[model samples]
Target: MTDMRAAFYDSYGDVDVLQVGELPDPRVGPGEALVEVRAAAVNPVDWKVMAGGLDPLMEVRFPAIPGWDVAGVVRAVGPDIPEVEVGDHVLAYGRKDWVQAGTFAELVSVPVRAIAHKPAELSWEEATALPLAGQTAARTLRDRLAVTDGDVVLVHNASGGVGRMGVQLARILGARTVIGTASERHHDRLRELGATPVVYGEGLADRVREIAPGGVDVVADFVGGVYDVSQAVLTEGGRYASIAEHDVPGIEDRIVWVRPDGAQLQWLADLVADDRLEVDVVRVFEELEDAGAALRANREGHGGKVVLRVSED
Candidate 1:
């Protein structure tokens, strides 16, 4: 059996528990493709799951390799798979049915349903960063909220990885105005992305109201704990969706859990190819040994996507 170098942890803990070592090559199952990982994205959920934060919701096995977003070349294909071929550049939100083998490694087996062609315009780091955050924002604003022309959209935590993507996607979806809640340091960056940046905290609703006197037509809450403020500023019959909040009363599907959708990812990649979307990756940590630092960088709030480069493209 072949082996691959990867970052894995035997038990759930902090970043310190992660170890760079060798593991068996991932098996290519039917309808899947074997990717030689070039880069993998670092998200908050990687460390959160490492810390056992998802204990009740997801089944996590011991010696779990952490990372869900990947950009790489297809090395081989499983039986009956035709969506991708060997040597094809691809990216995927590679979350499987369970938590075990993952993308922070030399190779990962990804279901074709989660795989999309990586556009030449994107670097490995950019492609790696796009799948999860981009898909989350698209699912919330485009798919769920149905943001459209002349809509006034408000994005909470607009400076965050998902929030930044949300801001850009709202513009792509034809929103006339976007008000983003972010720290003062990220205000200018948010403005550059076509959002009116408002500092979060006290008077956040007032600031949003000042931007849109009538009310916001849609609210995308990337950061949790701002439901009251969102409710205060939303117009009557306005739509709302949250990735981090789930306690809203009377809303059955308000919380959006992003799924692996290749078609959705392909659309985002095409947008990147055409310069309609930006994959804002602020930092890239090279090699398997730097996985801990990569996770720490993501946890420290870098205001953009973080990537771990596993191999040269």
Candidate 2:
């Protein structure tokens, strides 16, 4: 067995715990494909998990790799797998039952159910940026909220990575009108993506009401702390889903947790390929040794996703 270079941590902590070094290549299971990682994206959950934020909810093993998004080439497939062949370009939200061998590595063995063909229209960085954010948006809007034709959708914190995807996907899901809440600085970008932008603040509900007098048909909250306003603007019987704000009263059933679904990922990839979706990648860290910095960059916040280039294209 050969050792592969990876970014991992021996114990839970902050970015300082991450180290770039050699680890044994992950074993390919019966339904998995060995991916030669080209790029990986850093999500908020990655660093949170590193700090043991999810310790109560999910089990973690030491020497854990912290990442969930990957875009790569299939180097080999495990036995009984026929869905993807070697040399196929793929992207996935490769979150497993437990966190150990993750996407922040030179190689990762991805379950076939979580792998989707990467669109040629998207670069490795862009492809890597899509999986988690895109899937989160889809899970909230398409799956949970059931966004449909003629629906007027409202996306909270619509300038962030997942919120941006939610805004565009709302329109793509046949929304007659899509209203996005963000700061004034991001309003123009929201408009370009087919959303009516409203500045989020004291009058957020009023601003959204001005756009959709009857109220929004669906509300997707990617950022927490707007539960009051979200409820105020949601029409009676309207669907509301949140990836954040799980602590709010009566929102237990409304909280959405994104899972790895290859079919859903492929739908998002095809949308990007057909020019119906856009992936915003704000920064790219070129070295695996820079993983700590990448995690910090994501935590500091940006308008788009931060990605790590694991291998040259």
Candidate 3:
């Protein structure tokens, strides 16, 4: 076995349990491609899985290498796969159940369908940050809620990763009004992104109503407890899409599940290439060994996505 440096959690525990050690380098199977990881982004899922919160949803194989978003160059293509060849720059969503090769390693093997061309304009860090949050935002607005140019969309947590992308996607879709909820600190930045920023707090609903008195046509709620506020401002026939758990009246059937879709990712990549979409990488860690620290920092609610620099520069 050719050894590779990987971050692994041998048991369900705190961030202290995560360790950097030698492990077998991943090999591409049929319909898969081996990636020489350049960068990987840490998401909330990484911490949740490490803390054993998602054990029921996804079986935790002990000694799990937990990371989902990766950007790298193809090292090898498995037999029967011709869509990509060795040395192609790519970004991938390593959905644990579907493709378990974690990105917290120097190399990983992902299914062909899970990978997309990395945009030339974006760095490996920026590319790595886009897959999970970017695809979720695009799907929630374009496919699930059917948001259009005339729709008034309210994006909860607009300064966060998914929320930022949602704000931009709403603008691209020609939305008439894009209202976002964030703290006062992020208000100016949201305004720069073409959205009206409302402070998220006790009077969230009233503030949204004041901004869009016509009523919100669609609400994208990434904040867990915003469903009630969303329902209050949503107009008749409006839709509410949430990435977090919400049990609000009249929005029970509007939950958006984040599923990996390569075509949609490819579309976003094209947008990046054309300079239509932008990605923000707030910070990048220098090595996979720092993944645990990154996860802890993200869990503490530091702004933006945290990325790990996996390959030597």
Please, what is the TM-score per model? 0.99, 0.98, 0.96
Residue-wise lDDT of candidate 2 within 93-193, one digit each (tens)? 99999999999999999999999998788899989999999999999999999999999999998999999999999988899999998888888888999
Q: Which residue pairs collide in model 3, if any? A: none
Question: Which candidate wins on TM-score?
Answer: 1
- Per-model clash counts, in order, read 0, 0, 0
Worst 10 residues of 1 by lDDT: 244-253
Question: Comparing 2 and 3 by TM-score, which wins?
Answer: 2
Clashing residue pairs found in predicted model 2: none
Write the residue-wise lDDT of candidate 3 on 1-313 in tens digits. 6988899988888889899998888877898889899999998878888888887777777668878888999989899988899989999886846324588998898888888998788888888999998988998998988888798999999989889889989999989999999888888888888899998989889999998998999998887887778889999989888878555566557777777677888888888778888787778889877888888877877557889898964
True lDDT of residue 230, candidate 1: 92
Order by lDDT, highest first: 1, 2, 3
- What candidate 3 gets wrong by more than 4 Å, as runs, is 98-100, 246-252
What shift in Å separates residue 258 of candidate 2 from its native position after superposition?
A: 0.6
Residue 178: error of model 1 in Å? 0.2
